[model samples]
Target chain A: MFGGYNRRYKHFSPTLGCSMNFHIYFPPSPPSSPSPKFPVLYWLSGLTCTDENFIVKSGAQRAASKEGIALIAPDTSPRGLNVEGEAESWDFGVGAGFYLNATQEKWKNWRMYDYIVKELPNLLAENFPQLDTARHLYLSVSAFAPIGNPVNCPWGQKAFTNYLGGNKADWEEYDATCLVAKFHDVSATILIDQGEDDKFLHNQLLPDKFSEACKKHGVPVLVRLQPGYDHSFFFIATFIDDHILHHAQALNL
Target chain B: MFGGYNRRYKHFSPTLGCSMNFHIYFPPSPPSSPSPKFPVLYWLSGLTCTDENFIVKSGAQRAASKEGIALIAPDTSPRGLNVEGEAESWDFGVGAGFYLNATQEKWKNWRMYDYIVKELPNLLAENFPQLDTARHLYLSVSAFAPIGNPVNCPWGQKAFTNYLGGNKADWEEYDATCLVAKFHDVSATILIDQGEDDKFLHNQLLPDKFSEACKKHGVPVLVRLQPGYDHSFFFIATFIDDHILHHAQALNL
Candidate 1:
């Protein structure tokens, strides 16, 4: 068993209020160790979660200790200060960051894309010597629940249209498919595991779209679709060993 | 992030008293998902640690969530009343189980080996369906301090001694010169990464003894001694990615 400390910092999010907090877990490091030399794994949690969700919930420390990997889990969305009508539903508002830089009127100030992909990684790399920014991987558990084609479900179109601001083009940047294509230069391999029965993300739309986008950009993606599974951590936890192994394999360590 | 409720159980130890806690992290299961199964990575923390040490220190949730693997971390040693005098120093006392069952008088009740290798695994398998026991792997970091000739460290000696304890009166187990012969029947591969400058385990002892043991048993051991490294998690974290990759390659995942 090992114990370490987490230093918290406040980052300004135009979309969320001024009280947003991000955490960085630094493995206990000896002072004499080299600086700016550790690799990092950036984790994107699902909707209705803060950065603390994964940190508190996922049982990943053993593997991290064994593999010596550092994890960075960011809040799903911005928080603080009530945006009118933000609390209406569980899908959106405070918890749903959607990994996008919102462009719509009310959410124009919200920019999860930059915060997640750029700011968070930058902050972690700048602060921790044990983190290797050059070699980082991105992970998310079913972030696209209400956006894509619902397939055989009715809620799909409604959620997609509402969250996307009634335009398919608006979904592009926030869409992992589009994000992967835009950031094709990313060195880390993309890993997406989704349950077949996820109510928000129709199995067909997510894995297929993400795969298509990855393939188009020469990104190597290992997509595992568990049949009859739903959106839950059990599915994620069941396969975490493989994910660590995947990153480990990619790093060849 | 995934969280599960873990219940506490007590086991009696003549030497360590009644202070052992076992907890299992269960990933959330989606309503529609089939029974999810995950591979288990059992973690053994270093000295002065409880079951919670690695769980809190290592930033492994992101990878674990991504890979869906179950991580099980156990306490370093037994605690509580009556086990007082288990050792005269920090290296031998309440915090240092050493993953070995004690044979000496005042410490005879310290059966850490049984607790770690037998009881812990059994409890996990019985309680968590996501964990696959067949794919279990054992890992130790700075497990033993320098005990043998500086030229022939204690890691190998401890491992060999433990192996012998499990198979007493077997000369075949004493043969440490044949790698393949040593690991012939053990299902799990042995992976040990020690820092050359580790204050605890001498560099030469672990590697040499491990190599000799594996050679005698016809088992191949992967021992990596990082140059100028010390007995800190930083050294382990530096090469954690490699360890994951090794497991991936071994599992052919």
Candidate 2:
């Protein structure tokens, strides 16, 4: 291969009981920038997404390869461990974790929140020596969807009600709108691109809530409402490189 | 969106007897060369591949968008049908049509050759008016795997044997190695990328056969054996742009 391998790995996740699949793309070290270590970006896809979806569809690898930034894309939710009717609904049980920790009994083990933030990074850092150990690694504003689940409906309500119980306050930790006010990563600029014509905007996503949350908290957030764009990877594939550049800048590239 | 769109369409195929899905990407027309009509390249994926595989994983859109070459990716085989034992094996049935016309009584109707070379182009012309009607509208050298059944084995043997009957002569038409000597397209150069370390090479694919055939026929061919790369989109994503440029040159872009 011209660059290093875009590898797929399946490892035991202590957080999520089931074996999770994560795709990692390590940029080929160019001669000019001969640093052995690369800054890693954690990509958390939206509802009805998998690890392969972003890396596969987004056209991000070309820029990631060029910028010398390694990309780590985790599966949206845990699989294998049958968490009650997980396969029944497209949005509720599996494939729509919403990257949240379940407070309820049955799915309390659906710990994608911990997996993405903690376990995966630790695993990556330990396994791939090419990543800079000292640098901070976590997903921040570089996502295509609106942060908070829009008013807890569609997959969001199904996930929250099932995972976090009827108490809506418990959803705040996972909700982007609520989390932004409390997020401590002050330097990481919030970068969101919402398609104005996105089909799911009515019930599934609302960018204004997250935007307003950022504004209210006096945090830097740039929400670009792209006209004629949609919720499909068509949107992500359209602007993935810009998001990568935003990440590259954060990495001091 | 940076480019026009990675559009999806579902249409009835008279050949496959099923609703076929084809993904077409119309590259954004540049202001420098404003033309409503754009040349296109048809991408036929390897075994166990779908219409989304190349466009989703290969990172071809950015270069295609820049080159002003639209890409049409069709599913590997006819789907949405209750073909006998179609889902039983990965290579034999659903995902592994081998892109050949089935001559056997059971699968004579599996006319991927007709669909790809004829019905698809006509459909494209009828649906997308911006396409240049006079130009070629089918796949040639820009496929993920080697063509021409490679001495008749792997899924190729099963497909050819089942689809084209037991006659080896019947397979020659779809076989690139055999057809190179007979193909009349002397003006179009052949571009093939074979990863040297591809796992399928041992069992299924043989690029040397195709390469040797091209040389003997005096046809212009570039067979790049990418070292250490395997039979995956990783290889395609790495060298997709160069492949597009090759197609653009042929399209006289």
Q: Give the candidate number with the greatest DockQ.
A: 2
| RMSD, every candidate, angstroms | 12.3, 3.4
Candidate 2, B1-253: lDDT as tens digits: 3567788899989877889999988888777768678887888887788898776677788788888878888998888677788788887778888777887777655778888988998898887888775664533455555753454556677777777777788778888788878974665777778888887875777777877877887877777778878877777878888888888777767
Q: Model 2: what is its DockQ?
A: 0.47
Clash number for candidate 2: 5
Q: What's the C-alpha lDDT at position B10 in model 2?
A: 94
Predicted chain A of candidate 1: TM-score: 0.75
TM-score of each: 0.46, 0.86
Q: Distance from true position, residue B160, model 2, in Å?
A: 3.3
What tens-digit string does per-residue lDDT give for candidate 1 at B1-253? 3333233355554334465775454444445655777666566676667776455434343344445555566777767645556545555557666566665555665667777777777766675566777654453222222222321344434433432343433323233333244346654465667666676654433456555656577665666666666665545445544555555455554
Native contacts, share recovered per candidate: 0.00, 0.62
Kindly report which residue pairs in candidate 2 clash with one another.
Answer: A56-B56, B102-B163, B103-B163, B148-B175, B148-B176
Residue by residue across A15-37, what tens digits does model 2's lDDT show? Answer: 98878898988888878767678
Clashes of each: 47, 5
**Cα deviation in Å at residue B137, candidate 1?**
28
